[model samples]
Target: MQLNYSIEGGDFTNAGNASSQVKKILKKLNVDPKITRRVVVALYEAEVNVAAHAYRGEIIVDINTERIRVVLKDEGPGIESIENAMTEGFSTASAEVRQMGFGAGMGLPNINKNADELNIKSDVGVGTELEIITKLK
Candidate 1:
């Protein structure tokens, strides 16, 4: 199965909708509870990242018998340093975003922890794309 979601920048109120929907689908599919939890957490973090940093983006989710994959693509200011961006406490979110209780810099790390495979590619002046895969076990 495949699912796609558009994420609007700065839309904190709807940040978790995509993740919520994915969670519901996984439940209906009878996916393992632990796997569902991990998938939902990773999806939520990726969705929030787009809302907090990107101008706009879309998340594409694909589910197969053995694994679930999520791709987040954004047309926003790309990461200057992938190394730094992957760090737990590194973030470029604005003060206004921080005020909304996000941008605490935990998004990427949390995603990494929940995903069996995570990849991020970015160009400083271009954009960013993230691919995450979690195995069904």
Candidate 2:
């Protein structure tokens, strides 16, 4: 199955919408509880990253018997360094975002911990793209 979702940047009110939808779908599909939880965590991180940094974003989720893959593409100021950004407790969230107690810099690290396969690409001035995949088995 495949699903698509759009996200607006800085919209804290709806940050977890896509992740929640995907979680529901996974539950309905009867995916393994462990795998489902991992996917949801990674998806939520990616979704929040987009909302906290970019101007807009879109998520594409593809699921099959063997694995589930989610792609998040966003338009905003891209990451300057993936390595640094992946470090736990490192974040670039704005003051407003920081005040909300959201950006703890754990997004990418948590995603890496959960997703079996992860890939990220960004252009300094353009935007970013994230691919997270987890094995269903």
Candidate 3:
């Protein structure tokens, strides 16, 4: 199965909407709860990142019998250093974002922890692309 979702930056009210929908679908499909949890965590983190940092974003989710893959593409002030961004507590979030109790900088780290595999690419003035995959078996 495949699913697609769009995200608007600075839209805190709906940051996790895509993740929530995916979670519901996974549960109904009888995907293992543990695996479901991992997918949800990774997806939620990615979703929040786009909402907090991008002008807009798109998420594509693909599910097969063996694994699940999610691709997130966002248009915004791209990360200048993926290395630094990956560090725990590293954040570029605005004061307004921080005030909302989001953007604590754990987004990428948590996604890395939950995803079996992750790939990221970014351009300093362009945007970012992230691919997160998890084995179902």
Candidate 4:
């Protein structure tokens, strides 16, 4: 199955909408609980990243018998240094964002930990794209 979702930057109220909907879809499909949990974690973090940093973004999800793949692409000031950005406790979120309790610097790390395969590509002034993959097992 395939699904898509749109996100608006700085929209805290709707930040987790895509993730929540994906979780429901997984549950309805009777996916494994552990896999579902991990997917939710990764998906939520990815969604939040777009909301916290991008001007706008979209999420595309593909699911098959063996694995699930999610692509999150956003229009924003992309990460300057992906290496540094991936570090735990490192973030570029604004003060207002931090004050909202969304940018704790754990988003990427958490997604990395939960996703079986995580790939991120970013352009400094353009945008960022993340691909998170997980096996159904």
Candidate 5:
């Protein structure tokens, strides 16, 4: 099955909607609990990143018998240094964002930890694309 979600930038209240929908689908499909949890975590992180950093973006989810793939594409300020962005305690979120209980600098790191295969591509002034795949066995 394939699912697509449009993430509205700067909408903190709706940030996790995509992840929640994905979780429901996985559960309905009887995907393993562990795999579902990992997918949800990674997807939630990606969703938050798009809402917090991007001007606009969308998440594409592809699920098959063997694996689940999530692609988050955003047109925004674009990450200048993906290496630094992946660090556990690195963040560029504003004070207002931090006050909302996010921006603890754990988004990318947590996504990386939860995904079985992760890839990030970014252009300094253009945009960013994050691909995360988790295998189900």
Candidate 6:
């Protein structure tokens, strides 16, 4: 199955919408609870990252019998350094974002921990893209 979702930056009210929908679909498909949890965790982290940092974003999800792949792309001030961004407790979120309690700097770390395979690319002035993959079988 394939699914797509759009995200508006600074829209915390709906930051988890895509992840929530995917969780429901995984449950209905009888996916293993543990795997589902991992996927959801990774997805939620990515989703929130876009909402907190990007100008706008898109999430594309593909699910098959063997695995699931999620691609998150956004238009915003991209990361200056993926290495720094991946570090725990490292973030460049605006003060306003921090005030909302959404930028604890754990997003990438959590996603990395939960995804079986992860890839990230960014252009400092362009945006960022993240691909998270997890095995289903």
lDDT tens digits, residue span 1-137, model 6: 89999999989999999999999999999999999999999999999999998999999999999999999999999999899989999998889888888788999999999999999999988999999999997
Q: How does model 2 fare in lDDT? A: 0.92
What lDDT tens digits, residue by residue, belong to model 3 across residues 81-101?
A: 899889999998889889988
TM-score of each: 0.96, 0.97, 0.97, 0.98, 0.98, 0.97
Best by lDDT: 6
Error of 6 at 137 (Å): 2.0
How many residue pairs collide in each prediction? 0, 0, 0, 0, 0, 0
Q: Which stretches in model 5 have alpha-carbon errors above 4 Å?
A: none
Worst 10-residue lDDT window for candidate 3 reads 94-103
TM-score of 6: 0.97
RMSD for all candidates, in order, please. Answer: 0.9, 0.8, 0.7, 0.7, 0.7, 0.8
Candidate 1 wrongly placed segments (more than 4 Å): none
Which residue runs of candidate 4 sit more than 4 Å off their true CA positions? none
lDDT, candidate 1, 65-116, per-residue tens: 8999999999888889888878998988889989888999898999999999
* lDDT score, candidate 5: 0.93
Tell me the lDDT of model 4 at 31: 95
> Please, what is the whole-model Cα lDDT of each candidate in the order they appear?
0.91, 0.92, 0.94, 0.93, 0.93, 0.94
Q: In model 4, what lDDT does residue 40 have?
A: 90
Q: lDDT of model 5 at residue 75?
A: 93
By lDDT: ranked, best first: 6, 3, 5, 4, 2, 1
Q: How displaced is residue 25 in candidate 4, in Å?
A: 0.8
RMSD in angstroms, candidate 2? 0.8
